[model samples]
Target: MIVAAWTVCAGTVMPAAADTDPRGYLTKMKAQEMWKVADGTGITVAVIDSGVKDIPGLEGRVLPGMSFMEPPFERPDVSYPPHEDFVGHGTTMTAGIVGDGSAGGPRGLAPGAKVLPIRTSVGTPMAFAVASEAAKGIRYAADNGAKVINLSIGMTQDWPMGKIKPAVEYAQSKGVLIFAAMGNEGEGNNWTNVIAALPGVLGVGAVDEDGQVMPFSSHGPDTDLSAPGGQVLNRCNGNKDWCVGDGGTSYATSLASASAALVWSAHPDWTANQVARVLIQTAGGPVDGAKRSDWVGYGAVRPRKVLLDHEGDPGVPDADPLASPAPAKAPTPSAEQTAAAPRRVESADAESGLSWQWPALGAVVALSLGITVLVKRRRR
Candidate 1:
């Protein structure tokens, strides 16, 4: 089957050349320091992606979750048990959130939390057809004791929102905080995933180890936050080996969701709004001094600022700090705008004077069998 435009947002994965340590993202974000304050205990993060496997580091931490990859959503040629990963995207994402580093696997930012894995047809040809399944996943997550939902998936082209809107609203009403990837369409396409643009969902972008936004991270007003995504270490597809992701907003969303888990675990009584408010308030805002920017939203997520420094006033618990007026239709970028976009970005505000750029990267993996490169359309 062909890969769909809407795929897992883990980006291009390749066998690790070096840097096998999974602590890169944790060290870059300075998450270890915050772990002392909150390791996401008592929080269940729902991972809605290409399913999750009970891997080495995630043993005993994964709760049983339903799979939507049946009949209409599943390709006739492929079949797998519920919660079994096909592309390993969900497993990697789960590792990012709660992996405990057992058996020498990737370590998560929130080692004390549990994961609820929701399987869907992400990274498959049926991704677009299964768009409604994402909504169903959201509803299922909200009803199943999930406090935070992570959507490391998105479609390159806009999809119908009839099912997604209400599902997101339903999850939000249940006090669930949703985080989604801002697809890898990059700046030229400037496409924002419909799911990420929802009223309560926080759309996340990606930043590299150098603290600069990667070229492939999408840009737009809906971009709510940023996190580490470049060259992240992840588990290989359906295997025990480790692979390095070239960078995608998917990892960023996972880290951001984990950040919320840490904050929420520390302040269990705080509502979702209060957690979000603190995250945005403590984030490193744009260097240009703007309150919010399309490139990086409120700024790069810095949960440490809240957990370590005891920063951020958890103002009114019910107030929506990230809410904005209905988003206007985006305008097409002119020749000059496209030509001026930069390859690497250090600022998220519009006035930063950096242009946008898009560069596609491919994934190559060397499994026990052999080496193979995969080029597929996938999640945001």
Candidate 2:
């Protein structure tokens, strides 16, 4: 039985037992569901958060990533890079999304997937840094070959999602599926968070094992899907030995990313929209018509539906998901806007040609070694 009055996000799961740890749960779940075909074997997930460390369990699994904070904290997990997970929040997100247990840690929903760890935010104390730096990291991740993006951070800016929006747009054009977390103020429903509100983002919500929406989880038209959240479970404070009580839409977003990986891995040719639509269309419901509810969006995502039904049609590759034809007259970027952007920030997908593969990324991760890397001065 779940705890009442406790509100958490959906897609969150309980930690594993002593012998059957998170890694074991992942293995069992994958085996039980025959998810190896969609275990995200060769895909790359860009985890945008406080950044990810290449833990021993995930050795040779990580590629180079950029940071937005100021110096002393801008690099990826180098020898001296930020070793002690500053908040320890990002690591939890990483493990939940892509952990393929080699150690005693928990296995991720898409254990076979590789992760691109990028830092975009610090906390409420550094909102500005988070916003600006997240924008930079967004562009940097897209510039490389991140086919799927997972961002658990929220923004305070109210301006139309700005730089991150453009980067997401370009990524979509290049066939990347992006997932973001809705704000964690659903009880009050504040309107400041932009991470989940941006168009083209798979904004996720938090639900429990019983599928009740967490009171603290944010709700809006933006939250298109729900995942395990309230009174949730995962590596407690990065200690796989004891799972911690979890909440918030951040973790749910990561799971949504993992789900995208599963779908994408199954149908590599589908456009990002088709992958997203399959998840939404096949989601578990208390749903009614075409319109979705504000609390749970289309409904709780049951990836098992896709794993079983298996009749998804993602439309043509050239067809834009949002637009009918991607109007030719769409506003082009200004000199300043384009100048501030990093090289390949808009996705040179055709040029990059980095097709994701579990064991094959060794060469791409090497080639992407010296590519665009932006380290922010602060955590913002």
Candidate 3:
């Protein structure tokens, strides 16, 4: 069944983000053994979830973010006050990717990384009427200075690649890293689609502490890596100091994004694809990519190898992360892919100038993999 989509125009009446604890996301990610390399100091992670408040660990650190939710009619709906995290899900996800806050309990993989919250909803369907909303979020994140984007939710429908695909492509063009949950319905119905399966996205799956794939972790062809996403501790409501644990691909995706942050922060000169390649090449604890299972994709994420050993080459700097989606063929419900439709591209108010975030060594031509080198120069 398809859900009705709503519009969230800028002056609409929207609720504020919940102010409760949100540590569940981080602690679990760290416990999975992926934090050893995540320092994320120079990276900015865009968290598209319920809403993120200025909690203790995330205050002063989070920049102004946009709330794509619609409000009643008048009154400011800044996504901060009224909609506070009645459900601490978004905060937990955000914390997982980049939390340094003390009060929550668990710390993020990249303590120094910052977050740009895109207050979208997992509960209600909005302006996604045509799928432009997802694109809007992707573009907004890229244009604003977010080096990585994390989408932790999923829809129950299977729409073709129209607006959503391009939005992901555009973000990649601007050098943004996109990560989405593989889904938590592993043992259940296990239906998957959209943002998570898109060409440029990094589809993250969930695994347990035993390095075994969680029964509920969905097994789609899009899953790129398995990360700790089982029962783990995190922040939630009440007392604001208490912590709890839950498991889902959302947590796995968050940690994957943080892992990327650590590698990028360390090698600021590398492009998003280079960082991604380095990661896939060094991913941990042997599982067969050849005999791949429905549970674990590639393998459980082992980020320490990337930071400490740097075993593989960064490949071409301009290579597309999804350039070879051919390798990760996820099984679709229908043999036929939904019709591919082109869509709109929205510009964001955020700008990085690409300078403050990282230095440009002036290569005019970035390194390209699988091809002979051709020299090009932009004289300063």
Candidate of highest TM-score: 1
Kindly give the number of clashing pairs for every candidate: 8, 31, 24
- Give me the runs in candidate 1 sitting further than 4 Å from their true place: 1-14, 20-22, 72-80, 237-240, 324-380
The all-Cα superposition gives candidate 2 an RMSD in Å to the true structure of 15.3
Q: In model 1, what are the clashing residue pairs, if there are any? A: 7-378, 7-379, 8-379, 154-380, 183-380, 341-355, 341-356, 342-355
| Residue 207 lDDT, candidate 2, scale 0-100 | 60
Q: Candidate 3, after superposition: displacement of residue 119 in Å?
A: 0.8
lDDT of each: 0.69, 0.56, 0.56
Model 3 Cα lDDT, one tens digit per residue, 166-214? 7777888888988877665544356443456666577777765545555
Candidate 3: where are CA atoms >4 Å away? 1-38, 72-84, 124-132, 235-242, 285-292, 321-380
lDDT of 1 by residue, 23-104 (tens): 5767866777888789999999999888887667788788988787645434466555546876777888898888887664
Q: Rank candidates, TM-score, best first.
A: 1, 2, 3
Give the candidate order by descending lDDT. Answer: 1, 3, 2
Candidate 1 has an lDDT of: 0.69
* Regions more than 4 Å wrong, model 2: 1-31, 72-84, 101-104, 124-127, 234-242, 287-291, 318-380
Single out the weakest 10-residue window by summed lDDT for candidate 3: 354-363
Against the hidden reference, what TM-scores do the models get?
0.80, 0.71, 0.70
